[model samples]
Target chain A: MAIRSSLWLEYQIEANWTSPVIFILYNTLKPVGGSLLLLAMYYVVTGGFLGGEGLYFLYIGNAFYMLVAQTLFSVGWIIHDDREHYQTMKYLYISPLSYFTYLMGRSAMRFLLSLLPLSVLIGLGILLKIPYRIEILLLIGTFFLGWIFVISAGLLLSGVNMLTARHGNSIGQAFSGIFYLFSGVVFPIHVLPGWASTAALGLPSTYWFSLVRRSVLGKEVDSIMSGFTTGDVAVRLIIISVLFFVISYLTFRLADYLARKKGIIDMSTTY
Target chain B: MNVMLNLRALKGRAYPRMIGAVREPSWMFWDTFLPILSMAAYIYVYRSLDAPKEFEGFVVLGGVMTTYWMNVLWGMASQLYWEKETANLQLYLAAPMSKMSILAGMALGGMFSTSVRCISIILIGIVIFKVEFVVTSVGLLLGIFGVTLVALYGMGMVFASLFLMWGREAWHLNMIMEEPIYFLSGYSFPVKALGSLSAFATVIPFTLGLDAMRQLTFPSMAAQWGLVSPHLELGILLVMSITLLYVARLSLDRMERMGRSKGTLTMRWQ
Candidate 1:
């Protein structure tokens, strides 16, 4: 079952990349390049103690924050695109395959695919002379948390997409905008005034950035919940992740129930 | 008769779009809300921290003005891109009027419509946040407004043309502008945080427009304007706007020729 689903995910990804949608897909990465160029300019102007190499502390914190930040941006569209292309929601319901398994496989493939630009840009960071010890274990630890946050959010959204379909993409895009604004990606959460900071704190992406900042800049975590050890954050992340994952699964079931109630789950993405 | 005819077309063009604009409340609300939230979020955060009222007021107003400026200018530039790809351009081109009139009509109409959002922000800022209007230097403010508007729309036309010539790479460029321009504008943070190493950060129109608006609101800041305005800031906005307008027209003209030949060209993008 795993092998079959993995292969199916591969086929979907290959198809997405082989056509005009590649431009649309890469449009999702537009910020990564701009972020690179912006950081370069920032270093050039603010160099040393104030701006340059001395400020690498803030840079690492913010950059790592933005990576998960970018992931949370439009990754929900993995299924939205699938639904649009194949009207696959209905097909999923009727098929013998498990819905979560299928979607997870597809997301895993896309998660890898989306990371390509980020990996390249990470190398570009080295080219930019942003130094780091390159702690793989710590990196993967945070990446796992980020991935869990993102995948769960995407699932809930994908479940929403199962209902909204093509229009679901718009809703997903809207969340992406909100994510950029609220997440401490572009600016520090502490910089925000009052209510905005409260609202931002609720987003898991904020916590993901907190973790990423801790991992990358070797910065101390500020939030009590944020300062947990890798195993600690992971455990908490898993508990919260399970809730979201369950919510999404149950939401998809609700979506399926409603679709079955309405007689639309059988329809393909072509509509 | 020719002048009168174009004038009539312009009036007709502007009014219909103005009415059509309000029909899409979701887009309007969001286009306004996204920037407002971004700015408001900061204001709320700062107030929570008990930051000085003056500094908060200044950043909030700067954000409001900068956000509106970006939306208007970007909307103008992206009109064609939006219109063309969705296959809506063809329908507009086929309308019974001059293409230039229609293009001008769309551009003017967009400017007038979105300006309503800007005005609303100003009112909200004054009422809720006590962002003083500082109308003490209306004449200077007017001059600044004129320069800022001209610079914004002109560069917008330039970016709008990118869609015609480049098709989709135009979007790539547009997306790139979103974050970098915000920082360069110095809407949230002090100008010093931009770092002194590069003058390039100071010159973007977004930063210039914010500087002008800031000075206008607090006319006393006119002396300190030198800190923000180093002349190159003025030059870049001026030079870029005119040059971009010219480039945009050239690109459109090339499109015109090709479109005429192909006999399947659509109206210029919105």
Candidate 2:
């Protein structure tokens, strides 16, 4: 883990310039930035600053949605990219350490690296007169757990891709889009009909967004989930993180071994 | 005499790329689901609005229309981009076929796979979501789809041309143009809800496509106002698609002449 972490930190200092990374950042900025612009346009269109009562909620919700969604998705994208490029995976295969340690460190660094896009979103939120501050430890803890869970999920997907080697650049991107719908990222999960709402209910990301909405906007989610206390929420997330690591490691180790047997490890990184 | 032989060789080359693209389940799976899932999200979200609005059925068609064109355009454009970076592109180029024949293979594969998804989504929306469908004329709905297919794929060639020239930078920037516009164009939301001054109508194709779709969804809106003109929108998109495709073709011609693809993995901080 130590060696892997050190290598990844050095590696990320370099990956920070890729166009997709920039693309992700650009996409992050547009929604919040565009919303603030829409606020201006709303004034132009409706002839008022605070056009309607719910628009503020929409702004705050969308902004919070943007932060959690982007961070989680970026984590997935980074880890997926690692598997695709096989840059990390190369070292990961030959590392003098447990694969879990290697996977965790890579995921951790990528998870932290994903925070780059949020800077602009945070700036846009503050600029727009919406409340978008990080509330210290709890906010940090929420982000940490959320990012950890997301990265672990990414690691698990990485393991699958390790075997199949049938990687799609957009899997991370697509998974995020799919999850965004559920995790109250783009639209509130509350608004989703029974099947999708129930489908989203099973994901840890939904809970992550719940905590974000609570910490940021303090909106009541009574309409969404019932009888889940704050303490239960924390417990559930920790369990999710653990579940991800334990299960993913097994799949990853098996895939690693199989890929080696088949000599797929030496394959070109292009696809 | 040589031209006849070249045509046969072209057939030999282009046929595989088409069949192979379809045979790959991954391509078809995404084509099937991505559009439906995207449309389903809108259908899911709009339930919160006040029930008096008759926007649901109209909006669903627009959402489906947006998905259809997006798949055709984005799919076809990206196929070229994918072929470029990956080693397979060289393989395709090295084949004995003419470039246009090869491109036709790509366009056909993409369109066939995506249309399956589009039609399936419309069915799911109607069946699962209970989205209302009153077919005054299946002919009109089919007409919109026809125009959308030609315009979208033609414009896709236009987008693909830029990729052939400038590479990833143009490709990334161009992709952003597809989805964000859907929202602005009033695919999911009502044009009435778009505020009186939001001249999205003046600028975008969805405005016209959505109007044609709305004719099927809410004929009264079309019958009464005529302010929401379907023919005008379709005509504009048709012209725009041709113009975009023409520009794209020119760009591709230049790119093929240049023949420079730097496949370097630039180190960038994430």
Candidate 3:
């Protein structure tokens, strides 16, 4: 526990100390900028009108998407960075601490780190006067549940990263982009094509976003699974999250075994 | 003799960069795939809002043009940082060719590499979404595209100098700028809709170029927006290109001199 907590602290400090200003500005501005851009697109398309409901929807959706994106990216990239850039994979592999614990610790820290931006985004929502009753308990529940799903997804991605070390960052980015498109982050899944909507159903984010929109906006989700009540959706999310978490652990172990057999884990930085 | 040697050096630098980028199948695949996905996302956004059908074409065009912006920011501007990280910057600086020649080579190579992907994106968007392009004159359209490339690349030259001076911070700068540029340049909508923000957006060559291209291709839509004539837009692009290139050259020279004195050029972290 001490080792894991120290590792988390180390990562937190290193990431912030390296470029504090950029870190703050990027986390604060990037999501807000994206939301504003989407809002602008909405305004233009609607001929200069975005209702409070629409604005709030975009705000919560974009903020949550940013959180997911940053977590997935950090998890995948941190694996690549440790194994390749820092050449510490061998040390990590030999360490007393479990790699799974390390990842979970890092992810926990990422969730905490994500709050900075989430707060800023919520503050922006208040400033913009987007009406929403602040349901703290529900918001917290949604955030924790969403983090579990995202971290599981990230772990699965990190397993893929362990297998394909050179292309890890790009693969992570590609996954994030695809999820952003399909997961109803910016638009509802019902609006997507048949194949895409079907594919989205397989991902936990679809359910997660639906619940989040429900909790934050105090409105029922208008997605493909709109018939499901909040409790039903929550039950579905919990099931999927647990299933994926187990699958991700197995994937990581399998990839680790293969990497060791191939003798590629530590030597992957050459390319 | 020196001019001939420099020209030879430029060719040597450019061909390898061009070939190396194209030979990376993953890079090529992702570059083509990501933009189309982004365009699709925006198309969905438009659909959700009940936007006009023509706006799909606008989104597609804007998405395709963004490839150049990516090439400029990542391929050209950040080339120095990559080279620095790899310890090749010192060797390149010590070589016989002028630094500008190397950057020019990178710019040209980047354009070549990105153009292939851009054309793919355009074709995919058009076929998939059925975007109609009513080109008034091919010659005029090409002229606008040509000058826009020059102006955008010229802006890239300035970014390169600024990035080189910033060291590792360039990565953060690149990250910070991505979505904001998309917003400012009206990547998926008309800039006139930006209202007060349009003033800031016009300063970017990308906005001027995209707006002009859209106007030329969709004259009817252009009429509705009261967009500036294509010729005037071209003139503005030309002026911006010349001014940016001139200033970029001077800035690069000054930075190099200051770097030499401060030892910042060789420093790994700044």
Task: Report, for every candidate in turn, its global Cα lDDT versus the true structure.
Answer: 0.56, 0.56, 0.75
| Chain B only, TM-score of each candidate | 0.77, 0.75, 0.95
Best by lDDT: 3
Q: Model 3, range A1-271, lDDT digits (tens) per residue?
A: 8447845654664365356876777667766777778877888866654355555666688887888876775676666667755567788878887777788888777767777888788787766676666667877888888888888888887777775624213345556777788877777778898999989888788888888888777765565778888888889888888898899889988987887898877754222
lDDT per residue for candidate 3 within B1-72, as digits (tens), equals 388777877777688656666454555555567546767888887887777887888888898788788778
Docking class of 2: incorrect
By the TM-score metric, which is better: model 1 or model 2? 2
Which residue pairs clash in candidate 2? A14-B268, A14-B269, A15-B268, A15-B269, A15-B270, A16-B268, A16-B269, A16-B270, A17-B268, A17-B269
Q: How well is each residue in A126-193 modelled by candidate 2, as lDDT tens digits?
A: 54565544456667788778766676666666665555433233444444556556665545666776
Clashing residue pairs, backbone N/CA/C < 3 A, model 3: none
Residue-by-residue lDDT tens digits, candidate 2, B9-123: 5555446444645444554443456435645554544454333234456556765666655654455565566556444566655666555555555566555555566677778
For candidate 1, what is the interface RMSD?
7.7
lDDT of 1 by residue, A157-255 (tens): 666655543311224434454655576554556555468678876676666655665566555334333445656655555676677677867887787
Here the TM-score of candidate 1's chain B is: 0.77
| Model 3, runs deviating above 4 Å | A1-23, A49-54, A79-104, A127-129, A159-173, A247-271, B1-4, B15-17, B21-23
User: Candidate 1, DockQ to 2 decimals?
Assistant: 0.12
DockQ of each: 0.12, 0.20, 0.40
DockQ of 2: 0.20
What TM-score does model 1 score on chain A? 0.74
